[model samples]
Target: MEQGLALGMGLDVGRREEEEAASADEEDGEVRRSVEPAVPLKLLPLLPVPRQPSPPLLRFPSSTATRNLDASTRGIDTNRAPSTEEAEEASSSSPNRAVSSFRTGFSAQRGSAERGGVAERASSILSDEEENGLAKKKLRLSKEQSAFLEESFKEHKTLNPRQKLALAKQLNLRPRQVEVWFQNRRARTKLKQTEVDCEYLKRCCRTLTEENRCLQKEVAELRALKSTHPFYMHLPATTLSMCPSCERVASTPATAAADHRPSSFAALFSKPTPAAPRQPPDNFRPQPPAATGHSCT
Candidate 1:
C-alpha cells in the first residue's frame, strides 16, 4: 500500500507540471495578439495561513482583478485595472481564435437587449392608447345647442341618417347624441298625451255612473207602485154613459180636455149617478099614420 501511494504521488506531481507548462505556452501565444505585453501571473492562493488543516486547492477572488477580466471578456465597460493573477487566467483560457468567439457572444447579448427595449416601448404606447379609448368623456351642451335641437324636434320627430349627420356637423356633436335627444323628446310627448286621455276617460266613467244610479232609482219606484196597487191593472172597461147631446159637446173639444174626462175606474171609485137625458128641439114634426088604425081619431 505504501508503494502504491508513492507511485500515485509521483504521477500526480508529473501531471500537474505538464498542465502548468501547457497553460504557460497558451498564455505566451495569446499575449502576442495584443500590442501590450501580458502581465506575469502567480498561482499562489490569496489567503493567510489557517491554524487548522484546510481542503486542498481552494480558490477565491483577489479583489477587483477578477472583476476587470470578466468585464473585458464579456464586453462590459469598467474603470478598474486588471491584476497580474486575473491577466494570466485570461491569457490561459483565451487563445488567438477565442477572441472572435468572445466578441460574437457579446454582440449577440447586446442585440437581444436592444430588441427587448424596443418591444417594451411599443407595448407601453399601445396600452396608453387602449386606456384612453376605454375611458368615456362627459359632454355638456351649450344653451344654443339645446335651443337648436328643440326647434328641430318640433319640425320633425324623427330624422334620417343624412339629416342626423348634417345636424351633428352643424352642432359640433356626435350623431348618436342627437338621436338620443330626439328619442327622449318623443317619449315625453307621448307621456303627456297618455295623461290627458286618462283624465278624459275618468270623467266619462263618472258621468255614466251618475246616470245609472238615477235610472235604478226610477225602476225601484215603479216596482213599488205596482206592488202597492195590484187591482189597478184589472179594472173593468166601461164607458162614461152620458146623454147624446152632452157626448157630442164633449167630443167637439180638444184632445187634452177629452183626456181629462173621468175614466170608468175613476167613476167606480167616486160612485157618480148617471147623467139626465137631454130634451129635443122645438121645431120637430110628427108623421101621419100610414093605415086607418082608429079612423083618424
Candidate 2:
C-alpha cells in the first residue's frame, strides 16, 4: 500500500508541473502577439519616402491671343484689357511660389555671371510684349469695376495685406493696381475736402468784404455830415452862459444877435442907467395934517 501511494503522489505532482509550464507558454505567446504591431512602426523610419504631387503649372498669356486682340483694335489707342478669367487662372496657380522661384533663380545668376549681364538678364525673363513682339497692352477697367472699387472706398479708407489680396482677387486686378487705386481714391477725397474748405473761406471773405464796405460807407457819411454842418461838432466843455437880467441862455453869437440877448460877460461890463425922481400922488390930502402940526407947535 505505501509503495502504491508514493507512485500515485509523484504522478499528480508531475501533472501539476506540466500544467504550469503550458500556462507560462501561453502567456509568453500573448505578450509576443501584443509586441508585434510595435515592431513595424519602429521600422517605418527606415522605409523609403513616397513621391510628392507635382506642382501646378503657371499660366501665361498666349502670343496668338494677344496678337489677335491687338489687331482687332488697332490705331485707336483704346485700352485693350486682358480677360479677367485668364488673369484669375494665372494668378490662382501658386503665383507667390513662382515669384519666389524666379527670385531665387535671379539671385543665383547675380552671384556668378559674366559681363553684359544686362542683355543676358533681359533675355531670361520674357515679358508679355517681348514674347509676342507686340506693343505693351494697357488694361482699362470696365465701368462696373470702377463703380465697385468706388463703393469699397466709401466703406473704408485703407486696406491691410489680406484685404488688398482679397480685393485684387475679386476685381481680377493686380495687387499693386489695387494699392494704387486706394491711394488715388484717398487723394481725390483730400482734394475734394480742400476744395470745399476753399469755397467756404471764399464765401466768408466775401461776406466780410461786404460788411467792411457797408461800415466804410457809414463812416464816410458821418464824416461828410460833420464837415458840412459846424453845429454838429462836439460841444465845448464849459457850462452854458446866461444873462444876469434875462431868463434865456445864448448858445452862439448868431442866436444872441438875432434875439438881442446880452451875454453874461457883456452884462457884467455894461453901465447902469440913472433913475428919475419920485412924484406925489394925484389924489393927495395931506395939507390939513401938516397945518395942524405946525400951528400946534
Candidate 3:
C-alpha cells in the first residue's frame, strides 16, 4: 500500500509541477520537479555460457552405399537365395566330383549285379560254365588268383578247382570272396534240386497210392460179387475163355474153338454166309473136350 501511494504521489507531483511551470510567467515562488532520478547507479555483470564442440559426423563410404543400392536393385531373391545340395557338395568336396567318377560308380555296381547273377545260375555244372564263360576270361586265375580261386572253389561242387583258380586270378578278387560266391551258388542249386526231387516224390507217391487204393477197392468188389452170385463160381473152365476186346467169357469150347480165327481172318469172319454156296467140312476141329478147353480156359 505505501509503495503504491508513494508512486501515485510522485506521479501527481510531477504532473502538477509541469502544469505550474507552464503558467508561471512572473512568479518567484514556483518550484519544478523531475520524473527522472539523479542518483548513482551500480552495474550488474551479464554471464556468458561456455561454448562446446559439436559431435563428429557419422558417414558411410560412397562405395558401400552404392553396393547396398545395387544389391537392393537386383532383388531380395538374389541376396537370400538357398544353395543346392550339389552346390554344397561341390564346395565341400576335396578333389571335386568329376563326371568320370559317377560313370565309374555306375559301371562298378552293374558289374557286381551281373557277376552275382551269373555265379548263381546252376542247372548243370556245364550251365554254370557256359554262363561264366565271359567271367572266366575276365577273371582268369593268375598263380595268386588261382590260389584264391582254389580256396573259394573248395566250397562249391559245380566249380572245378581249376575253374575257381582261373576265375580268382582273372578277377583280382580275394579267395574268400570266390569261396563265398561258390558256396552261395552251390547252396542255391542244392535247394532248387531238393525242391524238384521233393515234388517228384510227392507226385509219384500220390499216383501209386491212388492206384493201390483202386486195386484194393476192385478186390473188395470181386469178393462181394463172388459172395452174391453162386452161378458165377459154378461156370465151367471152358466157359471162362475170354474175348480180349470185350473180355466176355465163352460158354463152351466148341464155340471158343470156332471163334479162334486170327485177327487177319476177321474180314472173312465178319462176312455173312452166302446163300448160293454149300460149305464143305472144315479140317480144324476140337480134340477131346478136356484138351480143347485147357488152352481156352
Candidate 4:
C-alpha cells in the first residue's frame, strides 16, 4: 500500500510539473474566456386579467316575481329539498337577468397581488373532489350548457362574485367546478411557458457546446502546426553554440551585453592561456621528410 501511494504521488508530481511547464511556455497574449450564466428553462408568462367590462344592469322580478322569490335570490332555503325542475328554472333565467349584485372588498385590476393571495387560499380550502378524484365526480356540462357558461365568463359585467355564483347555480354546477376550470386553465398556461423556457435552454447549451468543440479543435490544429514549423524547430548550430553577448549558450544575451560584462565572462576564467612552446627530446626527434617539400604527381 505504501509503495502504491508513493507511486501515485510521483505520478501526480510528474503530471503537475508537465502541466506547469506547458502553461509557462504558452504565449501571454492569450486572454481567459468568460462563461455566461446558464439560462433557466421555460418560465410562465404572466398574463394580466382581461379588462373589466362595464357593470351589467341588475335584473330583478320588478314586483311580480317578488311574491315567488326575492330579487336577490337570497330566499334560497337549503333545508327545503332542492327539486330538479326548480333548479332548472333557476338556471334558465337570462344569465343577464339582474340578481342583486354584491361589490367586493377589493378591486380586481388594482389589487391583483391581493387577488393572487385570495386565489391561493381558496385552493387550500378545496373539497375532497378536487384533491384526487376529479374523475369520479365529473361535472361534464352539455355542449349548450358549456357554451353558455363560457359566454357568461367572458362578460365583464358578470365577472363579479355574486354574478358568478348565480350563473353557477343556474347551470346546476357546484361553485367549485367553475373555480377549478379557471384554475386549471391558468396552470396549463404556466406549464406551457415552462416548457418553452426549457427548450430555449437546451438549444443554448447545444450551441455553446458546439462552439467550445470548434475552439478546442482549432487550438489542437495550431499546436500541431507550431510543433512541425522550422522557425522554432531548426535553429542554426552556430546560434545554438553561444549567446550573442557573452558567447554562452544560456540566459539573456541582450541584457548581458547592455551591462557591458560580456567579454570578461566565465569563458575567459575557465580557458588556459597559450604562453610558450617546448622543444622535443632528441630521442623523439621527427624523421626527415622522404622528399623535400615536393609533391609526387
Residue 191 alpha-carbon offset, candidate 1, angstroms: 1.4
lDDT score of residue 170 within candidate 3: 60
Candidate with maximal TM-score: 2
Residue-wise lDDT of candidate 2 within 124-206, one digit each (tens)?
22344322323222335656667878987877677543455567778766654576689889999999999988877776566
Candidate 3 clashing pairs, residues 3+ apart or interchain: 139-170, 139-171, 140-170, 141-166, 141-169, 142-169, 145-169, 152-179
In lDDT terms, how accurate is model 2?
0.39
Comparison by lDDT, 2 against 4, better one: 2
- Cα deviation of 152 in candidate 3 (Å)? 13
- C-alpha RMSD (angstroms) for model 3: 50.5
- Model 1: per-residue lDDT, tens digit, 1-297? 332222222222223222333333421233222221111123222111112322232222354345335433655322222222222222222333122232444444444434434334322111222212232223346667778889888877776444554566687665555766778889999999999888777765664555345446545643564477565333354334432322211111222332333332222213223444443532121212211011111
TM-score of each: 0.33, 0.34, 0.29, 0.28
- TM-score for candidate 1: 0.33
Worst 10 residues of 3 by lDDT: 41-50
Structure candidate 2, residue pairs in collision = none
- Each candidate structure's count of clashing pairs: 0, 0, 8, 9
Assess candidate 3 and give its lDDT.
Answer: 0.35
Stretches of candidate 2 off by over 4 Å are 1-136, 229-297
Residue-level lDDT tens digits of model 3 in 1-297: 332322222222223223333433332232323122211112111111111222221132465444334334544221221222112222222133222132434444446434534334321122223222222222333455445445544543544323433454466443233555667667877899999888777765664555446446545654665587645545455443443322223333334433443322222223333342332332122123222112221
Flag regions of model 1 displaced more than 4 Å: 1-140, 229-297
